[model samples]
Target: MPVQPTPGTPPQATSRQQADSAQRVELGATIRRLRKERGLTLVQLAQRSDLSHPFLSQLERGLTHPSMPSLHRIARALGTTQQALLASAVRADPDVTRQAIRVVRCGEGLGVPNVGGMARMLGSPQLGVHPVEYRGAQTDFGDYFDHPGDEFLYVVDGEVEVDLLTADGRVVHQLAAGDSLSYLGGTPHRWRALGDSDRFRLLAVQNATDPLTGTAEPHG
Candidate 1:
């Protein structure tokens, strides 16, 4: 006969439950680190990801877990992919020596889901600069972005109209194939494809870390 557990003793966690708890803790730490690296407060991250502040706080504390969609939103807001985030979380030592040269073959890269299209990461996170290729079908005027470091955009194909919101007023620019634009950090901007083309392709490069010093301006 097997002996019963002591009275009032709580049941032990199963292996699966233990594994899940470990993962949650790791993921939460990774999220918090990435947020701080981007100089974002929990509230700011919540706003960017369209997630509730309380939920994000709980997630960061490892008291709660996020769904796949929620994770994707967080990844997008942090300017990273889900795979990269997960890899960072699971790695024993992130500071390990990285490969001197990394190569991404044609049509090979981490694909990130976008509002009206897809974005692929062409550069590794260890490079300190993120190079992304965006292919979009529908125009997205509602998607405005502002972040901590400078950004450069090159139109690989098709045309796009960009609106930069400066302190004085909004400035607009029309870009076509072979055209490029660069902007300082913390500038509010939005862009949409021009013409009736089925899709447009753009190459964007941005700093992966916060380059600004002092307090960061609140993003509207």
Candidate 2:
């Protein structure tokens, strides 16, 4: 037997369900904004991602959610990464003062899902720098990320390998704990955790604007 609601009582959503609904709406808005930034229509994006236009439309309308593979395809089509898309959907502090000077306590920040590891945003985008802390288990060669402005990475623990795709060929660099690296923007690069422990922590910082001209660039 099941319980039924009273005639005048309205159905209510759980907190988790409400959060999911909000995230869905934010993600849809992000996708639509990115598509418009690239000057792409729904049909064009569908063709680029090999997904159906109707499905893309539904996704943008927040009526549907995309699977991991579908999301990867969409991210690739948008010249970004799945992590970037997820991070963009995360709700930041609405208060301007909070955004200006905020401190993220341990284990407290915006979490990004399904990026082959655990990642959290430690800084707000309003500060002109996006800082994310990544904890990885096992060696996972994630997708390459390329965006405007400069990027910096610091190894907080364990070891990792970074590959930079250059005009001539791929350049690989092995880094241990306390090691750091910096590179110009628009350079394709990817990284993976290493070592027998199969665990590592990395801090990645990227400029939110062009370093040379101080112009805003695409997030993530």
Top TM-score: which candidate number?
2
Residue pairs with colliding backbones in model 1 are none
Give me the overall lDDT of model 1. Answer: 0.66
lDDT tens digits by residue: candidate 2, 1-220: 1224456554442333444455566777888988998899999999999999999998887677665457768877887655455545545333225436666657555455435566666664446676878887347676776766578999999998999987878899999999999988778988877774346888988776532233556543
Q: What are the runs in model 1 whose C-alpha is more than 4 Å off?
A: 1-29, 32-49, 52-97, 210-220
Q: What stretches of model 2 exceed 4 Å from their correct place?
A: 1-24, 36-39, 50-92, 95-99, 137-143, 196-198, 209-220
Measured with C-alpha atoms, the lDDT of residue 43 in candidate 1 is: 95
Give lDDT per model, in order.
0.66, 0.69
Q: What is candidate 1's lDDT per residue for 21-50, written digit by digit as tens?
A: 555566688889889989999999999999
Give the worst 10-residue stretch by lDDT in candidate 2.
10-19
Q: Model 2 shows how many backbone clashes?
A: 0
On lDDT, the candidate that comes out on top is 2
Model 2 TM: 0.66
* TM-score of every candidate relative to the true structure: 0.59, 0.66
